[model samples]
Target: MTIERFILFSITAISLASLFYIPKEKYRQALVSFLIFQAFTWPGTILLVQFGKIEFPVREFTQATQVGFTTNYLFYPMIFVWFVIMYPSKACLTKRFLHYFIFVSFSVWFINFTTIYTALENPLAGTLFSQTTRSYITFFAYYYISHGFIVWFSKKSNLSIGG
Candidate 1:
């Protein structure tokens, strides 16, 4: 298969495999985080594609949707699940901020690198800031907003966050 297809398939396999790593006691937390994060990613991805900010040229469900189904609906949410479950809850404000920075930074870097190497156009390239800058902003926004929602949900449900 082509490298792009191979990369996508590998990502899918890894994401699926990550699910088994979640502890049994945290299964409920994992499910809640996954579903809630998807609530943000799905529409956020669609809007990004719709407005020409991004495109997944090699993606599943192309005929049904322009969004990258595997990345938006599955991979990203799974990442968020781990993020919430492993959060450094007792960390000071600076460390907490660093956590956000680290996650967003790595995600954006990996995404930009992979998409470019895989022959997909970089999202929001040259919109205003450089492509990497714009991607950082976009990813940080998604993570921040979804994290807030997850925290709120956990509070309302009386569920504890962090391992």
Candidate 2:
């Protein structure tokens, strides 16, 4: 198996395993940190290469574009978790689009600019993102599943949203 596939499998396994341990609130914090770590690595790596000219030691082994901290990973899961986590505390405004769209539009626009620049220099290094492929099953798909369980699991325990 390739590195990317291995990472994907490991992410799936660990993410699934996270569900069973949610009764203990402490683990959830660790889980969130771990997920954030997974999200941060690739984009951060590509950014470091583009700006700093750091020659990282690794071969390109995979081309799966549908998942794994590309562009869309952060946004949708934030949306899913936002609703469930905030629930009654953070009031969902009637015009949800008004609040959320600007953030997405700006992020996509800004990131696309960077992507264009980076792709010109090092094409294979960065996450070549598109709209539909953002919703990949391998990565963020678990968030929706875990979001529901997390909401339910956290509700059962004394855990608040952030913790």
Best TM-score among the predictions, by candidate number = 1
The C-alpha TM-scores of every prediction are 0.85, 0.30
- Model 1 sits at a Cα RMSD from the real structure of 4.5
Q: Write down the worst ten-residue block by lDDT for model 1.
A: 120-129
User: Which candidate comes out best when scored by lDDT?
Assistant: 1
lDDT (10s digit) by residue, model 2, range 87-141: 4435466544343444345434534443454321222333555321331322334
Q: For candidate 1, write residues 1-163 as lDDT tens digits.
A: 8887777788799989998899999898889888988887788778878888777887777789877777778877888888878888799999888988887777676677766687443465464247778767877787788778767766754456862
Residue pair clashes in candidate 2: none
lDDT against true structure, model 2: 0.41
